[model samples]
Target: MKILYLSLRFPYPPFSGDKIRTYNILKHLSYKHSISFVSFMLSPDEKNQINKLQEFCKEVEIVEFSKLKAYSNCIIRSYSGEPFQISYWYSPEMQKKVDNLMEKDGFDLVHVQFFRMAQYIKKYTDRRKILDSGDSFWLNLSRRSKLDRGIVWPLLKLEASKVRIYETEIAKWFDQVTMVSPLDMQCLLSNDSNLPISVVPMGVDLDYFQPGSKSDDLNLLFTGTIRYFPNKDAILYFYNEIFPLIKESVPNVKFYVVGNSPPKNIQNLASNGDIVVTGRVEDVRPYFDNSAVFVCPLRSGSGMQAKILEAMAMGVPVVTTSMGVTAFDAFIDKDIMVADDPKLFANKVIQLLKDRELRQNIALNARHLVEEKYGWSSIVDRFDKIYENALANRS
Candidate 1:
C-alpha cells in the first residue's frame, strides 16, 4: 500500500508523546507499505531529521512554520469561528504540497495525523482519508477551559467551543477517524452520532524501558515538555502543593524534572536543593530506571500520557491523577496509584516511597501490562489494519 501520511509535526527524535506515536507506527508500517510523509517542520532541527525519516519513508516533505508566522496566522483567524490551534498550524505551503502530492501520486489513502492537518484534507470526499486524532481535541480544550480561569478564561472557552464544532464537522468528512483511547472515541461519538471511529493506543518501547531490578536513590520524577501548558501547570501544582506535603513525611525524597525547553519558572525550581531540573538529556530511560516513583500531577489535559506508559514499562510504580490514567484501565492498587487531591497524591507517593515491597509489586504488574497490551509491535499491528482498511475502501 502507498500511504500518504500527513502530520502536524515531523515525527522524528520521538521525544514527545505525539511524535513517538506517529514515528513508531510509521517505522512499523514502512516495513510493508510504501509510506511517504508531508508534515510541518517547527524548527530547522526538524528539517534535518527529515533525512532520518527518509531511511524509513519513501519520501519526506516538510513545510517550515515559524513561531511568529503561526502567531500571526492565529491572530488573523481569531475573529473567525475556527479554533486558534487549527489556525496556528494553517499554512498555504502545506496545502499546496498536499494538493500537488494527491494530484500526482494518487495515494492509496491519506493518513491525517491531527486535527490541525484535517483542515487541509477534510474537503476531499473523493479520497479515502483516515483522521488520526491523537485525542479528542474538543475534550482537551474543554478541560483546559475549566482548569484555566481569569482573563484568559473567555479566550479558552471560545477556542474550546470552536474546537468542538470543528471536530464534529471534520468527522463528517473523513471515512474513518482514530483516537488513542476509548474515552476519546466516546466523546467524539457523543458529538457526532454517525461518525466512524477506531482506537489505536499509544505504544511504548518495551525493549528500551524494561524492568530494572535495582532501584536507585529515593528520587521521584516528572518529565515532559515543561513549557507545555498542562505540564507546566502539573509540575507547578506538584511543587507548590504536593511536594511540600510529601517532604514532611519523606524528607529524603528528591524530585527530578526531566525533558527539554522548560519554562523559566520551572527552571527556577531547580534552585531548591531537593528539586533538580535537568532540561533535556541524551536519554530518559536512565532517569526512569533510577526513580523510585514516577509522578504525574496533570490537572488539565487529555490523551494517554507517554510518560506514564514509559514509566510503567520501566517497572517503576506510578502515582498519578485520575486524568493521567484515563487511557489505561489499570487497577489502582495493582498497576498504579491514582490520586486527585494534593494530599492524597502526596500520600500515595509517600506510601510508594516507604514501602519497597508494594512498589516492587506494582512495578511488576505495570511492566507486565505494557508488555502484553501497549508494546510497540502489538499496537502498530492495529494501525496496520486501519491503514489497510482505509486503502481497501479507497475509490
Candidate 2:
C-alpha cells in the first residue's frame, strides 16, 4: 500500500506515547508498504534524524514549528469552538505541503496522526483519510478540568466543550479512525455515535524491556515523560496522596521516578530521601529491574499509558488506577491490580512489596500478556487488515 502519513510531531526518538506508537507501527508497516510522511519538528535536532524515519517512509518531509507560536495559537483559539491542540499545530507551510502531496502521485491511504494535526487534512473532501486520534482529546480534557481548580479550571471546561464538539464534527471526514484502546473508542462513540473508529494498541519492545534481577530493597517505580501534564499530575498524586500511606506500612520503601525531562514539581519529589527522580535516562529497564512494583496514579488521561505497558513487558508487578488499566483486557487480580483511591492504591502496592510470591505471579502473568498480544509486528498486522477494510469501503 502507498500511504500519505501525517503527524503533529516527528516520529524520531520515539520518546512519548504518540511518537512510540507512530514510530513502531510505521517501522513495521514499512516492510510491506510504501509511506510518504510529512510532519513537524519541535527543534533543529530532529531534522538530523530525518534519515531514521526515511528508513520507513519512501519520502519524509518536515517543517519546524515554533513553540512560542504554538502556545500563542492554543490560547488564542481556546475561546473559540475548536480544540486548543488543533489550533496549536496549525501551519500554512504544512497546509501547502499537504495540498501539493495530494495533487501529485495519489496515495492509497492518507493517515493523519492526532486531532492536533486533523485540522490540516480534515477539510480535504477529495481523498479518504484515517485519523489516529488515539487520545480522545475531549475526554482527556474533561478529566483534566476536574483535577484543576479556579481560573484554569474554567478555561479547561471551555476547551473541553469546544473539543467535544470539534471531535464529533471532524469524525465524518475520515474514511476510518483508530484510537489506542477500547476505552478511548468508547469515548469517541459517546461523542459522535457515527464516527468510524477502532483500537490498535501501543506495543512494547519486549526484548529490550525483558525482566532482570531486582534490587534488594523493596521499591516502587513510575516511568513516563515527566514533561506531560498527566504524568506530572500522576507523579504528584503518587507523591502527595499515595506515598505517605505506603510509607506508613513500609517505612523504608524507595520510590524511583524515572523518565525524560523532570519538571520542577517532579524534581521536588527527589528532595525527600525516599524519592529518586532520574531525569532522562538513556535506558529505563534498569529502573524497572530494581523495582518491586510499578504504580501509575493517573488522575486524568485518556488512551493507553505506554509506561504501564513497558513496565508490564519488563515483568514488573503493576498497581494502577482505574484509568491506567483501561487500555488493557488484563485481569484485575491476575495480570495487574487496580486501585483508584490513594489508600487503596497504597495497599495494593504494599501487598506486592510484602509478598514476593504475589509480585512474581502478577509479573509473570503481565509479561505473558505483553509477549502474546502487545508486540509491534502483531499490531501492524492488525492495522494491515484495517487498511484493507478502509480501502474496500472507499471503493
Candidate 3:
C-alpha cells in the first residue's frame, strides 16, 4: 500500500507516548507499505533527526512549528468555536504541503497521527483516511478543567467544551479513527454514541527495556515528561499524600522522578534527598533496574500510561491508580497493584516493598503479560487489519 502519514510532531527518539507509537507504527508498516512521512518539528534539532525516519519513510517532509503563531491563533480564534488544540496546529505551510501531496501523489491511504493534524486532510475524500488520534483530547481537557484552578481554569473549561464538539464532528471525516484505549473511546462515545472509533493500545520496546537485577533498598519510581500537567499532578499527589505513609512504614524509602522538563514545583522536590529528580537522563533503564516499585499515581489523564507499560516490560512491580492500567487486561493484584486512595495506594506500595516474594510474583506476571501482548511487533499487526477494514468500508 502507498500510505501518506502525517504527524503533529516528528516521531524520532520516541521520548513521549505519542512519538513512540507513531515511530514504531511507521517502522513496522514500512516493511510492507510505501510510506511518505510529513510532520511538524518543534525545534531545529528535531529536523536533524529526520534522517532516522528516512530509513523507513520513502519521502520525509518536516515543517518547523511556530509556538508564537500557535499561541496567537488560540487568542485570535478564542471565540471562533474552534478548539485551541486544533487551532494551535493550524499552519498554511502544512496545509499547502498536504494539499500538494494529495493532488499529485495518488496515495493509497492517508494516515493522520493526531486529530490536530486532521484539518489538513479534511477536503481529500477520494481515498481511505485513518485518524490515529491516540487518545481523547476532549477527555483530557475536561479532567483538567476540574482539577486545575486559577486563571487558566476558565480557559480550560471553555476549551474542553469546544474540544468536545470539535472532536466528535472531526472524527466522522475519517474512514477509521483509533485511540490508545477503550476508556478514551468510551469518552468520545459519550459525546456522540454513533461515532466510529476503536482502540489500539500503546506498546513498549521489550528488548531495550529488559529486566535487570534490582537493588534491595525501598525505592519508588515514576517516569514521564514532568512538564505535562497530569504527570506533575501525579508526582505531587504521591509526595504530599502517599509518600508520608510509605515513609512511616519504611523509614529509608526513596522516590525517583525521572524525565525531562520538570516544572519548578517538581524540581523543588529534590531539595530533600529522599526525592531525587533527575531531569532528562539519556537512558531510563538503569533507574528501572534499581527500582523496587514503579508507581503511577495519575488521578487524571486519558489513555494508557506508557511508563507503566515500560516498567511492566522491564519486570518492575507496579503500584498504580485505576487510570494507569485502563489500557491493559492485567489482573488487579497479580499483574499490577492498584489503589486510588492515598492510604490504600501507599499500602499497596509498601506491600510490594516489604514482601520480596510478592514483588517478584507481580513483576514476573507483569513481564509475562507484556511479553504476550505489549510488544511493538505484535501491536503494529493490528494496524494492517484496521487499514483493511477501513478500505473495505469505503463509500
Global local distance difference test of model 1: 0.88
RMSD of each predicted structure: 1.5, 1.6, 1.1
Candidate 3 stretches with Cα past 4 Å from truth are none
Question: What value does the lDDT take at residue 52 in candidate 2?
Answer: 97
Q: Which candidate tops TM-score?
A: 3
Top candidate by lDDT: 3
Q: Write the per-residue lDDT of candidate 1 for residues 1-395, one digit (tens) a residue.
A: 88899988888888899999888888888988898898888888887677889889999999988789889999887788788988889888889999899888977788889888998987778888888887987788788888788799998888888888888788878888888998888888898778889888898988887876666589999989888888989999999999999999989889999999998999898888889999989899888878999999999888899999999998899998888998996888899999999999999999999899999999999988888899888987887787677667763
Clashing pairs in 3: none
Stretches of candidate 2 off by over 4 Å are 71-80
Candidate 2 C-alpha lDDT tens digits along 42-101: 889999999999877899999889888879887777667576767788888889998899
By lDDT, rank the candidates, best first: 3, 1, 2
Candidate 1: clashing pairs of residues: none
lDDT of each: 0.88, 0.87, 0.90
Q: Of 1 and 2, which scores higher on lDDT?
A: 1
TM-score of each: 0.96, 0.96, 0.98
